[model samples]
Target: MTSRTAQNGGHYGAIVVGGGQAGLSASFHLSRAGIDHLVVEKKTAMHKWRDERWDAFCLVTPNWQCQLPGHPYDGDDPNGFMVKHEILGYLDRFKAKVKPPILEHTAVTAVERHAAGFRVETSAGSFTADAVILATSLYGTPSTPRAAERLPDDILQLHTVDYRSAEALPPGAVMVVGSGQSGAQIAEDLHLAGRKVHLATGNAPRCARFYRGREVVDWLWDIGQYNITIADDGMGKKRHDTNHYLTGRDGGRDIDLRRFAQDGMALYGRVKGVSGGRMLFEADLTSNLDAADRVYNGINALIDRHIAEKGIEAPPPSVYVPLWEPAEEPAELDLAAAGITSVIWATGFRPDWSFVGLPIFDGTGYPVQRRGVTAVPGLYVLGLPWLWTWGSGRFLGVAADAEHVVEHLTAAVAAPRQLMAQAG
Candidate 1:
């Protein structure tokens, strides 16, 4: 840990905002390049993994994917999934090894372009730097649908970030909105805990945890799926838009919506609106389910083709059949009659860049950058979805992306000095 007091109003070669994997990685590379930098964090390191996750939460990806810059996973169980504690431990060890200059509990309030390069205002104090790397993860704010406001006052609403466990929820049937990974897993958790779960299905893709005698993630990695950069112009847009629905339970398991339906989870299409204390759903539940099925099958087909082309021996295909019938879904669901006392919004999240006083954001509020390099010279962003590669935002890819960003930062820091020398 660096001296927080020393950083107050001090100038540096660069400043990395955020102390998670992305920030830590950036610090590592900057230090390695002999550049002076400080990593400012709002809370303790790996705050989200420590505080935001549920009790039973485990990484969907295998332990092998837990790759940091210098600290790679040399654990005994590479195929197993790491729980929350395990992840925190891994990060703690990485922080200890790297020993980057980090100021804990220091929150950045504002970032503005300054003559020195950038002026960063934080809870501690203000500092100027020649470069700034915004390493905050993509999902900074939990997003709930607008319809949530119209729900009855008696109905308790909690976003996925606020949800800790099923025991914390009120004793009644629960409606979990959004069928993404968190929603699906939470619905299963609530259902198993004796609560009737109503899941609003979305267009998230699903895949079996294991396929053809190998983990699906392993297969994807072997097929260079993670290495597919946005620059390739191949399935990058689609991959960036879609969220994969799988679970890290019972070693690893598939979480299809049909399975939840068969297990007594009331499945509905996207929640369209709310009126008269009644929730309205889209009538395209079957279509949404079919779309998910297509994605699942498509992944399997790709694996099959890879196996055939590579001459690798693999098990025969084990087809999955839909258990739920496609019937006319009710257009409206009465909240009172349904006995739903609580609503858990698993709708997902969006990045919060309100503190950044720069014109680098796009029309959609996402930062406009090319592979972490912002339009502004001294500004950079890391751990953002599709920032460079398909896995750019993930733990497995953050280190590599950080290295690339820091390389640019190195040259960015030198340009001014070179110009001054030339003029002299």
Candidate 2:
């Protein structure tokens, strides 16, 4: 999408804040409806994917699921995962295909109601629109724990966003906190690089990369897992669930933290505090590991049930066995004693909605909307996890949600015009 100067903006049918996949998808549907709209982005369209991700980052899902609106994956390796560059290239092509009217390097500071409909104040200038779509994703703010500040000033620290490679780190052991997707993957990255790594684990779940003669994701898709919606499923709160950890790096594979422990990677429980150059941890390392594996096997059990019920001819179902177990829960580790020169915090992110001037949020600061359409007419939120379906945030489902929201938006926009014509 080409960047336009925001200063010339007078009024638009709609204004979409954000230029990521979600915003662009909204733009695609708006353009199809001949809705004169503008997408205002804080940075370039692919800034998040390009800037925040590490060098070795790749999609956890297969390339086939990277389906943008009107642009399905036509790549030769549909089942394979796209690395960082390949993912960006796909998005760049989609941007070219959509060619949505967007303004880059424009930070939207506030969005509030106005006489026209809504007034969006941006760093560049202000614009008015009849409707607004907040396409900025849920994970906008990087969240590091307050305990991080208690560490010694000399110890080098980095968030997952700033971490690049093992070689970039100082010459010493590394401590990684939070065992979610990013923590697990980056710990493996360092382990493979022959670095001494200490991992403080969380209760994030895991899933098998492949099971029953096909990828588990393929099975999930076939079993209608992705089709399950938040409103329809009992586990609607899965939106807030920690993402199941696996890897798409070097062709997909299961990230068994137990395997990492067996391979000499130091494993610890959740970090409780950092003080006096020592990191204190809970005595629940074994429990945390077992919790992750239970989810892994639980997913496998789900696939097995699907296969048996359908009588599908597939490989025999199997269960996962832990390769290693922590002998004891280490309560505290002196960073200086362990020679840990650096630390990586993969604690994930929180949503930033301070700019939104609407009372659409719930107690948790999450926008309260029904499949992207907010109670406040003319304002909506998209790209949030579990907005409608489990796939809502990913490329697999954003297109569908965008279409649904825009359809509602189109009807809303037409109702007034129709009433005016009838009155005339």
Candidate 3:
């Protein structure tokens, strides 16, 4: 790129790019540590969180768990899950409290390595800092599979990220791809809205928020799960582990699929490919359905253990069976005959790093860092779940991770920067 230089230079101690939860949390720590820094956010105050989320979306984590140091959630319903709006509100309020010198409505254009540090160029201006922390999230892109690209133009295909409401959907039947939370939720929603719905199920795994009537999070914690940070293969393991649980149920409560069957939603095995205005796949959804059952049993067992340990009198949750299942293989559902004109892909998301010009990323689009420390000097990450523990990167546990990262960043910038003193 162009040689790094700036004309109007008022040197900043550090610069943070992207003002998402990760960036804001890092900035919060920097402020508490007495570090003077500039935060460059691409959008207006908290727009990233507010504008991007779909309708009726609540954080997968409970409201009580949403927090940052000195800025924990203190709303009326602590136990309920916070919506995207509430989260955006909290971040804006936090930014105001810290008042980090942020320049909004400007996107980072390019970043070049300077002699002493790095030169960060933005829409509004250029800034030089001793360290640059990029807080752009992994969920930056909406990944559509290649097979989906071959779909006929007549059928409507939409990623879950872009889907807002049933009003946006065209008339006829709806076929939801993938069996993840979004797929289950959207399928359930569309079905209840009085549309013929076909759920193209794939590698689905059921989850329980509570098993045996005890919170699933508590069970995972008690069993020392999510603690496995830094697996043996490191980047390979991290990339492989990135995925969402298919079950919409949490704490043993039904989300979408539990009641979806009651609305006449049909379950089918994987969709192999689409051709001749028809979607072909094996009707033998036997193994896939079996896998779902296995997970249900496993979660129930965990709850049973919890009950036995606590000596609770209540019985386990009663299982609700699905309405219909495909019995044979290579089952073909003509998109036209099924009257399914639209496809909603709630399959899952994979991070894209085409814009991120850092060498620290692995092939699978995950950042290469050990507890947020990168091979590139002065490069650090915070607010990643399971960065050091299962909870480290999760909503409930991210505050502690942010605390650690802020502590480290403060030391990185404060211990040096003697040039300013000498120049003064």
What candidate 2 gets wrong by more than 4 Å, as runs, is none
Instruction: Give the range where candidate 2 is weakest over 10 consecutive residues by summed lDDT.
Output: 1-10
lDDT of 2 by residue, 128-218 (tens): 9989999999878888999999998878999998999999999999999999999999999999999999999999999899998899899
Candidate 3, overall lDDT?
0.66
Q: Which clashing pairs does model 1 show?
A: none
Candidate 2 residue pairs in clash (backbone atoms < 3 Å): none
In Å, residue 118's CA in model 1 sits off its true spot by: 1.1
Please give the CA lDDT of all the candidate structures. 0.86, 0.91, 0.66
lDDT of 1: 0.86
Instruction: List residue ranges in candidate 3 displaced over 4 A.
Output: 1-10, 84-92, 221-228, 231-239, 242-252, 255-263, 282-284, 306-325, 418-424
Q: Per-residue error at 288 for model 1, in Å? A: 1.2
Cα deviation at 58, candidate 2, in Å, is 1.0
Candidate order by lDDT, highest to lowest?
2, 1, 3
